[model samples]
Target chain A: MSKLTIVANIKAKADKVDLVKAELLKLIEVTRAETGCISYDLHQDNANPAHFMFYENWQSRELWQIHMNNQHLADYVAATEGAVVEFTLNEMTIID
Target chain B: MSKLTIVANIKAKADKVDLVKAELLKLIEVTRAETGCISYDLHQDNANPAHFMFYENWQSRELWQIHMNNQHLADYVAATEGAVVEFTLNEMTIID
Candidate 1:
């Protein structure tokens, strides 16, 4: 199985930045402890406070899929439903 | 100085995937050797061949700015001018 890299960008609604960010930060600890997780780091844009990104590396795509379908992720979706305005996810492979 | 994380997404014109990728790859060696570089990893989308991203970490934003203004980056811009269709850069700080 090949390693997978995920770049997920999340943009919060103008009035919901804190709400959205809190929910995102909550995912880090649990996700980092999951099986096959290599690294799960979160960042907030320096110039755009409402923009956040997760730069993650997983042992394999299959394990990443498992992580995606976990209950905590569902909880996140429910918690930030309307607070998130734009979300884009890219599943990538390292060039090397 | 605070550390900086950069998420740069680049999309190539459908027919120019190889060209754009080659040019992007050309920056790795020199950029990695730069003074403040911590990591300069590149990735290509698994589902979209034309989508490429660079996930970089630097010792500080000031050092990153220096890297941005260096000749290799300028050369990359010139080399992939018409071949790239979209580009977005996010300068960020790790949440901790």
Candidate 2:
């Protein structure tokens, strides 16, 4: 399977930062358990408390696609309906 | 030193892909040798041949600032000239 490295950039609403963070953290455990998930790490911007990102590794695009449509992901999106202001997904491949 | 994770998203001009790749790769060795560099991983997009990104871990924002002024980085920027289209820098912190 070809590897896929991703940087998911997220910005939580100013007033809902903590709630959004709690909801985002739940995705980590559930995402790591999915097939082809090699690494799923979450990060926040030190200077910007409301900004967040996820550095992820997947065995293949196929597996990642499935995980994207997983129920947990849907639940997360639903839970954070107005909690996020900006959400961007960046899919990458190692240069080595 | 406080940790700082960064995702540098880059896009190379269509004609300068190989040259840009070469220049970008040179940063790996040099950046890793810097005082606070813990990890400096380069990656490209699977679907976008011209797109690239760097996943970096620095010991502190101060060290990273010094790195920004490093000669190698300056040289790379100069060497590439107009080879880049869009460059976005994202600073992050581990959520753990």
Identify the leading candidate in terms of lDDT: 1
Question: Judged by DockQ cut-offs, is candidate 1 incorrect, acceptable, medium or high?
Answer: high
TM-score chain B for all models: 0.97, 0.96
User: Where is model 2 more than 4 Å wrong at Cα?
Assistant: none
Against the true chain A, what TM-score does chain A of candidate 2 give? 0.97
lDDT for position B93 in model 1: 94
lDDT tens readout by residue for model 2, B1-96 = 779888888899999989999999998998899999999999988778899899998999999999999999999999999999999897888885
Which candidate has the top score in DockQ? 1
Per-prediction DockQ comes to 0.80, 0.67
Per model, the share of native interface contacts recovered reads 0.76, 0.71
lDDT of 2 at A76: 91
